[model samples]
Target: MSKTAEEVKRIEEPYVCSKKERLGHALGVLGHDGANTMRGYTMPFLTDILQLPAPFLMILTTLGQVLDAFTDISMGVIADRTRSKWGRFRPWVLRAGPLFCIFMALSFLKLPIGVVGMCAFAGFMYIATGSFAFTAVDIPFWSLPAAMTSNTKERSEIIGGTTTCSSMIIGLTGIVVPLALSAFGKFEWTSYFFTAAIIAVFAICMYLTSFKLVREHVVPDDSVKFSLKLGLKSIFTNQPLLCVQIANVFFLLSIILRSYLNYYYCTYNLGNLSLAAVLSTINTIGMVSGALLFTIFSKRIGKRNCLFISALVCLTSNLVLYFSGWSNVILLFTCAAITTVAIGFGYVCVNAMIADTIEYGEWKTGQRNEAMITSTRCFVTKCVGALASVLVLSSISLTGFVPQATEQTLGALNGFHIMYSLLPAITMVLAATPMFFYKLTEKRHAEIMVELAARKEKKENK
Candidate 1:
């Protein structure tokens, strides 16, 4: 337990995961992100396809996010304490696949074309799935990694696999969804419905394989009882956790806002909506590459340093994009690709760092509330995601942009650039600032793991 380098080096071997666990974990994350990719269309789908007002769409999405903020932790607390033969978190993860598939498909269904009926029906379905049903799966799903293994490299592999898989799915979604819609000859309910069915089936298969074969190595103590106040308060006491949450909010805000604006950037700025697919594919490739590269980068430079580097890359790309993207498509794609890659790197670092925080929390707080800890992860994502939605709504209203319009005014175009560039530039910097306060180094985390192992061993022997 010394701070000696020799001790740190000798403490753990190079943990080689089996092919089954590695592949299964990757598929599980892919399924989770794919379902979200399908449901996450609430703002874009309603505005683009249904021609709903941004304000109207905003209310539904914001409400869902707000409700989800509260319920996410509640679900985490419940999952953390549950005693089941299948295990605490796995049961929830196992059931989420089919539920989301059904709900996501229904949300995309071409209900009778009346405005009021469509709004109520789709809104309910969207909220039901996004806020309630999906969180049931998401909180526990992310929680599983911390419980699965205490080895830092092994955790990175799990998080890295998830990040890479999710990025690939998102990249493919950008390419796939548009192509699917093109086949229908126009954007309509049919496009979404058919596409959702395919995504749903594949996602279900991914989840089934993950839980059925792959294993979780760390399980929560059955002795820890669930408490609403204790679960809520734990978030504040964990300094490293708080630091991670703050950084995550800003970083994810930048990511989501850029994604929303990319549609407009490609359609109006590039003058061809279909080019969105091309640019998306580029970003996707870049992101997957970045995630892979950062896997090595974090090992060399440390996770916090890698994250700061990611922020710098994103800021530079957005700054370039804002000043010059309107004039050239090549610059736009190149910078966009760079931005996605940076974002992908950041995602991997943060995910792995969060897993470390779970151990840090248990070491310091004497409790490892994986479900609650990971719940904050989801809550920050949704919370910032809500703000990004608002940023879009305000941009739409401020720009005097009309939904389903064939074209937009110059002012509206500038607004898109501001969001796509200036705003994210600011958030990217903010994301990095908090990483400075994150004090959990790799050596420190390894020491914590060794001590925690000794503590557990002492407990079992008694």
Candidate 2:
């Protein structure tokens, strides 16, 4: 017979472990699933490889992202209902990881087709197919942390450590890719695609290595029917989930805008592509350091409080960036670092908070749907990403950004500045405002867990 919830909780109590083991596991998961590959490669590909007009490229990419929302949510529902000896999340990751890598590599292949036609085809196929695979892997992977341990403080530590490692990978990509392309003495599309393939292989191997090490404590209920309508109903009815979804839309919108504009600011405003690495390095350092520190502080301050503080810091950093003059690279770097740190703290806590909401949902509806919960998060993220892409590109088009211009017109430069600074700053501030209403606390979570354990025990004994 399966162990009782009380017995399982007791056995899982010594949640702390070696840093290297935890970091490896975290990096393995993040490298394979953190959506880092596209961030590192796609924008550059659109700009440098296909040579499609930026506005058109952005519009197409946004549409592709929007299309993925349905796929991600559907996969989540399927995963929650799936039963496998390999575990619900792990098996999907194993099945989907290589496929995702293959698709990612193929997305970069430069077809001899016309730029617009090729880009449209590539964007549609890659985003649609890759998103399905990604959702399959991602839903379960994220849900595993909650199942990994029930200890609140331990969960924070795990999340913080894992997030730090993940941020490091993201940081490395931001810094190294530009440098690597530069070192190759040519920035051909083929070279970038080849490099991504190599890195993706390594990432997939790392993720696979953890398959044997990490264990899932929760099992899927195969008897439960999976229904898209029911899944939507469950998600819409949950208050905390609703709050998180709304907040995430704004949060992701801000981040996506910042990412889309980063290239523009570096290439045109900063006047050096290499500066991307320097900015990325500083931002990444801030993120890593902040995650580490929050891991330590979360043990004392609690996740909600940490999230609130993080929002304040992020808001302040954005204000600094918006107000600071363009020539002030040092100030910009400092603000970027601060902003990264804030985002780091917020990201870890927010994820942990969502995990807690799974228990809340169970308490309310007598169901555990980690995949559904996670997919909701992904849905918000993708929807926001789509909106951001459209906004950024539309703004560029409105400002008369010329494709292949030797230098940007003053109007184009102004558009870039407003996009890089004003748009993100406004959205971030709005995102943080909703967190004040987030009502879950550690004390409440503890009470919920205790009740859940008793309820499960009574049901099992019968």
Candidate 3:
């Protein structure tokens, strides 16, 4: 054997996390999911509870997302360059998690001001929660799995477990929030604030606990200094990360629109607001079940196949729901269940694929920007959310949707159907389109890791 081949054969040891650390990571996700569940209700809260105009809320959220785009990149660069005893990602997660929860709860507050004043306050809080607080916490939290382990299987399990755990808790929130609001007399501003406050408290506790429990294992290379130019270069030059972002943009669009429109679908179209909670529970079950199934079958089917299958199932189920109409509640529930299961499967695939790209960036460019790539993911997500908000509210305006009305116009109902079903189906097709160009497979990733391990060892030996 050649000397070079022998030298390259020395692979670095994989860092295996303890069960306690894994649990801590999952707990942090539970906190984040709890806070986001409230954000999902922002559209309904502003429209139904505050009686705000759809167009106004749309414009406000879009502005917030625009600001969010800049913050996401800035936070990513900040996180990558961060150095302390606590490590790059953990300090951000620990410090910013509680702030994220607090800002989120504050966004739902009802003031004595007029509509314009309330709008101004809401916009301020929206920027605070999404652009600043959430940006700091989210970029760091998502970057953790890659920093925690180099072992692909371990990272997959970690991400999968956290996602499943988050889905179940979010599902519980779905069940509980409606009941709480109903008991408190339906969409009251005080009730909304109260619910948001409780979630914020719970989230704070989770973040603090996770800070004490988890630790970062994979230290970043201190040699590669982070600059705006380097960050932009990392994003532009890395092909795999770009492809993942493309897929994520459409995927987020479909998912965010569904979340934003779910309240309208349940309340106006189905004539019962409480049913949204029930559907959330059902989706939670479906997602958890689907994630478990993916864990078992992903190795055999491959991640790309999982993505395509999920898109196919989601697209088909949504279209079927659109054509069948909402008269059949049972059918609606069936389709929702099937679609969420596919979502659960697809969620794991996307996260795992993103984690794999961290190594790919390092191998190809000699600079690993885990948090920067994660920030770009956040950027795509916020931009898509902004676009979805505009589309939903524009449709609302066109349909002449009445805020807090018991009865909606036929056009408004049709709009809900399109937003909930047809739009998502079309976007699902777009979401899966980029993955076809994604060439990084498990076998290829394994080879990259081996090469990276060798390169690192050689650098240290020098």
lDDT of 1 at 92: 79
TM-score of 1: 0.94
Q: Is candidate 1 or candidate 2 better by lDDT?
A: 1
RMSD of each: 2.1, 3.9, 2.4
Pairs of residues clashing in candidate 1: none
Candidate 3 C-alpha lDDT tens digits along 1-462: 123423333553555899999999999988888888877777677777787777777878778877887899889899988898988899987889999998888888889999999988887887888888899999999988888887777888899999889878878788777778777867688888888899899989999888888888888777767666766777787788788888888877877888778778888899987898889888889889888888987889888889889899999999999999988999999999999999888877888788878888777667888898888887887888778878878877899788878888999999998989999999999999998898887666777777777687798899
Question: How far does residue 49 in candidate 3 sit from its true spot (Å)?
Answer: 1.9
Q: To one decimal, what is the Cα RMSD in angstroms of model 3 from the true structure?
A: 2.4
Highest lDDT among the candidates is held by which one? 3
Instruction: Give all TM-scores, in the order shown.
Output: 0.94, 0.89, 0.95
Q: What are the runs in model 3 whose C-alpha is more than 4 Å off?
A: 1-12
Error of 2 at 69 (Å): 2.9
List residue ranges in candidate 1 displaced over 4 A.
Answer: 1-17, 223-230
Please, what are the lDDT tens digits per residue for candidate 1 over residues 1-462? 765545655665456557777777788977778877767665666777777666677788789887987899888888888777777777877887678777887777766668888788878887888788888888888877666675667767888888898899988887877667667844577778888888888888888888886676666676765666656566777788888889999999998887776666666656666887897799789889999999788879998999899999999998998888577878888888898889888888888888778877778667778889899999889888788888887888888777656688888888888888889999999998887788988877878777876788799999
Candidate number with the higher TM-score (1 or 2): 1
The TM-score between candidate 3 and the true structure equals 0.95
Which candidate tops TM-score? 3
Worst 10 residues of 2 by lDDT: 31-40
Query: Can you rank all candidates by TM-score, best first?
Result: 3, 1, 2
